[model samples]
Target: MSMMVNSPLYPDDVDILAGALYAWCAERSIKLQSQEGLFAANVAISLYDAGYHTQDQLLGALHNYEFH
Candidate 1:
């Protein structure tokens, strides 16, 4: 038997996203539920959807993004 899901990301892709989000928040002391944290999450997801699927690629893009 097999199961099908309708999502573009895989488990490892989620892991990289979580790890990058954690590292970014930890470095800046940003709460996971805070506004900036939400922004970071959005940016991460956007970058991932834009083909920044690798850990290094996502992290680098996240770091490069300014929080204005």
Candidate 2:
């Protein structure tokens, strides 16, 4: 499942977040419908909400996240 774009984010932000989510999941071979995938989505959104706006920032934070 894709992350739901929140009202505060612009289209570019959405693109960055989505791409980050995709890369994060892809690296771990995680299905978006699974528990881990859900966690990843949540984490990505949370990070974005917290100010990791760029793809590199988001992905770096995500990669460092201990998702399991």
Candidate 3:
């Protein structure tokens, strides 16, 4: 399932990453509301593009990620 997200830079495969992020967050009980989902999707896409291709990597990134 593809999640609808609004972001500035969406790559061709962003939806795939976003869906993975949605599932990842869901598994962790993270609440990514409608508005916040856009940012979460963006972060997910960035991580995916950066070569962190697994949920565990994303989970670790989320733990160490600092919002600027």
Candidate 4:
């Protein structure tokens, strides 16, 4: 899912990714508050867009619960 940066609807992408991540987490028995999970997903996406082009970067973002 691609989100248009700097657009009014950009924040909506956070919700979209959050929902997907939330479901994935739930399936894995990971308990994440809605806001926390959403922020984590958003940070992952941001790090990706920032040219952190590696699996490690993605994993780090997801595992870094202090992001929010």
Weakest lDDT window of 10 consecutive positions for candidate 4: 1-10
RMSD value for candidate 1: 6.7
Quality of model 4 by C-alpha lDDT: 0.54
Considering lDDT, which of the candidate structures 3 and 4 is the better prediction for this target? 3
Q: Cα RMSDs of all predictions?
A: 6.7, 3.5, 6.6, 7.0
State the C-alpha lDDT per candidate. Answer: 0.82, 0.84, 0.61, 0.54
Clashing residue pairs for model 4: none
Q: Over the full model, what C-alpha lDDT does candidate 1 score relative to the true structure?
A: 0.82
Q: Best by TM-score, which number?
A: 1
**lDDT tens string, model 3, 7-28?**
4445545555665777756765
> Residue 53, candidate 3: how far off, in angstroms?
0.8
TM-score (C-alpha) between model 2 and the true structure: 0.80
Instruction: List the candidate numbers ranked by lDDT, top first.
Output: 2, 1, 3, 4
Query: Candidate 1: which stretches are off by over 4 Å?
Result: 1-7
Q: Give the residue spans of candidate 4 off by over 4 A.
A: 1-33, 61-68
Ranking of predictions according to TM-score: 1, 2, 3, 4
TM-score of each: 0.81, 0.80, 0.51, 0.42
Clashing pairs in 3: none
lDDT of 4 at 30: 58
Taking the tens digit of each residue's C-alpha lDDT, what string does model 2 give over 1-68? 24564557778987998899898889888887889888888888888877898999999999887766
Indicate whether candidate 1 or candidate 2 has the larger lDDT.
Answer: 2
